[model samples]
Target: MSIELGVLVAIAGLVISYLAYQLTHIKEVKTDSQENAEVKAELGYIRRGVDDIKIDLRANEKQISQMGERITRVEESTKQAHRRIDQLKGGDQ
Candidate 1:
């Protein structure tokens, strides 16, 4: 009878150990899932920021091109004015 009691106690200890292992595993899985979700949210925010920066860069490029064209037109007008002034001075001579 003592041997039977010892065997039963051993079986109960094994069952308790298995339950504890399962609970620990479940907790670890839940923690990992939460962390992954947070990481995904942060990545989405970063992607949106990058897209905004790209739009701003495109607008700046367009402005720079417009400025360059305006400068070119001004330079051409200055050359034409200089030629006109030279012709007027020669006619007076």
Candidate 2:
């Protein structure tokens, strides 16, 4: 009878240890899943920011091209005015 009791106690102890191990594994898996979700969310936010920057850069490039054209037009007008002034001066002399 005493041997039977000892065997039962040992079996119960093994079952308890197995349950504890499973519970710990479940907790670790949940923690890892939560961490992975947070990482993915952060990456999504960064991707949005990069997309916004790209849009801004495109707008800036367009504005710069427009300004360059305006400057070229102004330079051509100035050269024409200078040539007219030189022609008038030569006529007066």
Model 2 has an lDDT value of 1.00
- By TM-score, how accurate is candidate 1? 0.86
Q: Model 1 shows how many backbone clashes?
A: 0
Please write out the lDDT profile of model 1 over residues 7-72, one tens digit for every residue. Answer: 999999999999999999999999999999999999999999999999999999999999999999
Backbone clashes, each candidate: 0, 0
Candidate 2 residue-wise lDDT at 19: 100
Q: In candidate 2, which residue pairs get closer than 3 Å at backbone N, Cα or C atoms, i.e. clash?
A: none
RMSD of each: 1.6, 1.3
- After aligning candidate 2 to the native by TM-score, how far in Å is the CA of 78 from where it should be? 1.4
Estimate the overall C-alpha local distance difference test score of candidate 1.
Answer: 1.00
Point out where model 2 deviates above 4 Å: none
Best by TM-score: 2
Residues 1-22, model 2: lDDT tens digits: 9999999999999999999999
